[model samples]
Target: MTESILVVEDEVRIARLLQIELECEGYRVSIAGSGHQGLELYQEQQPDLLLLDVMLPGFSGIELLRRIRAGDADTPVLLLTAKSSVEDKVSGLDLGANDYITKPFQIEELLARVRAALRLASGRKKVETDSWLRADDLELNEATREVMRAGRTIELTPREFDLLVFLLKNKRQVLNREQIMTAVWGYDYYGDTNVVDVYIRYVRKKLTQDNQEELIHTVRGIGYVLKDSL
Candidate 1:
């Protein structure tokens, strides 16, 4: 099946160019000029990936991302923003954007990111013999995309959920930031590694919401490991 992409860019010329190029690449494309319409189309289409802009009329892309991640945690969202600061990018990534490209981006770069995001999303959805991933009392239902600890549910953003899944799959293996970022985020992150730390904290906070033990252990000066006991 041809993968679908929703382009939520207010810029008409850019949107047209992206749609033309993306369609040429054989993807089913949908365009929304405002954040409101973007969200509406997003619900209606449920595209495989989103090419969303940060600036949009009414609600911003960040707000749109927040709303989508509130319910759907698997769709790949690649933000299209003009903001180039690390802070700006981190803000989007924190909101669960799979990746981002600043405006004036090369078509090649943008296409590459689109492919990577879709590929990562596809890889995560592959069926496995085991439906549940667990560590002690903490468990994740891949089929349901639910996380639970000691029978209590934990709500996680898309990024946090992916991070936790990676950690759980690696169990006792110590995974460095580089390895974690590559496996979870698809492409190697060019920004600060703090993004990994930020996500780890998010997952840890949720997993231990009721004073549960932190199954993810930090190895000072190295990285982190998920284990029943450190």
Candidate 2:
């Protein structure tokens, strides 16, 4: 089936250009000239991908992205913004936009980003996940974010759960602090790397509540790795 793309831009010329180009590429295109309409159509249509402009008549693109993520976590959204500030890009990525392109972008670049976002959404792996993570008698259901060691339930914050998943997903591979920060916290961050260490400590403390075998292994001079064998 042909991919569907929703173009949400207040500028008539830009919207039409995008629609025409995307259609030429054999995609089904939908246009929404205002943010409100775009969001309304999104909830109803649930297109494969969105080419969303930052400035809109009623609602801004940032607001639309937040609303979309709040409702649906899997939909891939590529933001089109006029601002080139690092802050703007970081905010968009942090809010769950799959990617961003500044205004006055090349048609080829725009098309490439569109294709990449669509591919990511389509090719995402749906893990046959159980209710929780289990290592021996310890368990943590991913669905409920409940952690239990030796039949005793352990509560964890959202960030701690995210950290645990990241480590688990990359089991046996040493991931640097920068990589953890980028993957878990989103990009455009230049702050201290201590945050990654802090979250790792939090997860470790929770996992070791019952003095269970440690699944997270520290590399001393390198980084963190998650594995049962190590």
Candidate 3:
């Protein structure tokens, strides 16, 4: 079946361009000019993925993301904005956005990101068939995309979950930032490597919320490692 994508961008030109490009890439695409329309289309179409632009007239992209995450946490959301600050990226990621792309972005890069998000989403569905990755007391169920530490559920964003899963799959091995980024974010990712650190911090913060012993360790001047013991 062809995957459906919902694009919520206020700019008419950008929206049409994206819709045309995505459709040309064999995806079923829907465009919304406002956040209100986006939300309605979201509820009605339930697209496989969402490409959302910030700075909408009625409601901002961040607000729409928050609302979407409140009810649907599994669908991948990619945020498009001109705000390239670390703060904005962190805020969007923290609010459960699957990926972020700065405006004036190359069409090739945008298409790559959209493909990566959809690929990840597809893998998530396939993994729901009893696949589990474990490290120490932390357990990640690929099938359900659930994480648990010491038998307690731990919430994680899609990126965070992917990062943790990558670590677990390569447990006890030091993974450099480049490797982690390429593995988790896709090979065509053009973002800075600091994104790896940011996501690692997010996963660590959530996993250690109950004062649990850290399973992920910084290798210092090298990379990071996840092991049963330091």
lDDT for 193 (candidate 2): 91
Worst 10 residues of 2 by lDDT: 125-134
Tens digits of lDDT, candidate 1, 133-169 = 9999988987778888888988998888889889989
TM-score per candidate, in order? 0.58, 0.56, 0.57
Candidate 2 collision pairs: 131-141, 132-140, 132-141, 133-140
Q: Give the worst 10-residue stretch by lDDT in candidate 3.
A: 81-90
Q: Which stretches of candidate 1 lie over 4 Å from their true place?
A: 83-86, 127-230
Query: In candidate 3, which residue pairs get closer than 3 Å at backbone N, Cα or C atoms, i.e. clash?
Result: 128-143
Worst 10 residues of 1 by lDDT: 122-131
Q: What's the best-to-worst order under TM-score?
A: 1, 3, 2
Clashing pairs counted in every model: 0, 4, 1
What residue pairs clash in candidate 1, if any at all?
Answer: none
lDDT of 3 by residue, 1-230 (tens): 99999999999999999999999999999999898999999999999999998778788888999999999888999999785567767888999999999988899999999899989988877877558888878889887788898999999888888899899999999999999999999999999999999999998899887778989999999899999854
lDDT of 2: 0.82
Clashes of 3: 1
